[model samples]
Target: MSDIDFVGLLSFVPAILRVTTPILLAALGVLISDRAGVLNIGVEGMMLSGAFVGVVASAATGSAAAGLIGAIIVGGLLGAVLAGAVHILKADLILSGIALNIAAAAGTTLLLFLMTGDKGMSGSLASQVLPKVTIPVIADIPLLGTLLSGHHILTYVAFLAVPGVGIFLTRTPLGLRLRAVGESPESAAIAGINVVRVQVMALIVSGAFVGTGGAFLSMGYVSWFSQDMSAGRGFIALAAEVMGHGSASGTMFASLLLGAAEAIAVALQGRGLPSELMQTVPYIVPVIALVVYARRRQRLLARA
Candidate 1:
């Protein structure tokens, strides 16, 4: 920690924002599902599926928008399936999620091999990239503009989603019911809310958010999908949600904090540090942050 160069880190704000996009998006998904009383541990699988399908669809159609739509559709479908497994099939949510993640990892690799004869990546495909957005007046504001403007469109969407999610959960009727169901399914059911339906919907929405994050990985952050491209980001997003304690804004901030750590990890590469240790830094920071967050929560609760 003392070895980190503070001045150099300042220049990485944009990189932090860029990397934070997918994490924030995925964390939002986790937040919603958690709030709705359903935990979708298969978010990683959903993200991978979306990434693969998005790249494939965009390559075939020559449209990034189509790729995004494809990711969302696939993600939502997967979410619904997981929901069914937990709610209707009476499967353990954690075990079912683990199974889904394993299946998705293998299935996507197989599909990738079948399509491009390369299990590592879809380098052969010419996929369309999502456009970057530059705020008009904001772009001209010297230093501030440099930091604030010219991000991928999805970055804006991801940040905007923070508030949007908060509003949806706090101000909407469906949100209230979802929370009620999550808090006490029996009570919610007694009050005439279909607990199963709400859980299913929450999972679907969660999947959609994860899917969008996946799409950003393939289309916005990079131009192609690789096997296991999600690379534990789903888990990091989960951590962000846990650290945030299921608040949209808090989750967004947590994701950004992790993103900054990741950016520092990237920047520190090849700078006299052991390559393996530098690689581990990004993952290590989140664990530390989560521990700190947990400690803080415990203290607060003890005081209360």
Candidate 2:
């Protein structure tokens, strides 16, 4: 390719990473819960709530860090609520998750209306944006600088977390117990693992990761939270987790692919394409990827 063409293509890398950050973080969260056999279908709601909480807390305290912490705390509480619904109330897991999503959507809007007297957005609030990080030495490099430095802090955290999650799941004692419970709660119980406790912890951890993603949405991606700003990214994260087949590194790659699709759509919007059609690109890519993954899995099973 020509140098100009190559450079133009490379320009998209940063956008891809920026878009991928929240999806990757949330996908990792989904991976944790799924591994513990308690899929967090309410991850969408948790993310939406987190975004709202982050904005409100940041604006109220004049501290972005406080917003992030508040978001994480709220996400964990939502996860605990989900766990309670399943374990204590004996609610169907899937139904409970769906209910949470519905409640989060309505609840955030209601809270936003009460706070700023606006239900659709947080424009009245003076929320802080999380700062971007510029690696000192890396920032001086040519193409490497663009790819590796000067990203929102959460972007770095999300990427670094891939290996951290991988290690936790594969090398830790708690990881083993969580996996055992996921594989067979009955067997795990017989083996002396407290299935309920393990699942609860997994959901909390999952929600924490998800909350960070939500914080990114409001604090890093934009300085204000909009109604439904999550924009179905949480659902996309679920697809990424499924595409990842329960592996952190795989999920990261899947998130990048989906992020690239969204980035391309954004780019296309400037090229005079219908904005409505372009908006569907991100969602469409996941459907296609999932179909391919399902076919591949079926083929492997047949071969087996």
The TM-score measured for candidate 1 stands at 0.95
Q: Write the per-residue lDDT of candidate 2 for residues 16-97, one digit (tens) a residue.
A: 9999999999999999999999999999999999999999999999999999999999999999999999999999999999
lDDT (CA) for every model shown? 0.89, 0.94
Return the top candidate by lDDT.
2
lDDT per residue (tens digit) for residues 48-83 in model 1: 998999999999999999999999989899999999
What lDDT is reached at residue 1 by model 2? 98
Model 1, C-alpha of 182: deviation from truth (Å): 1.0
Q: Candidate 1: worst 10 consecutive residues by lDDT?
A: 1-10
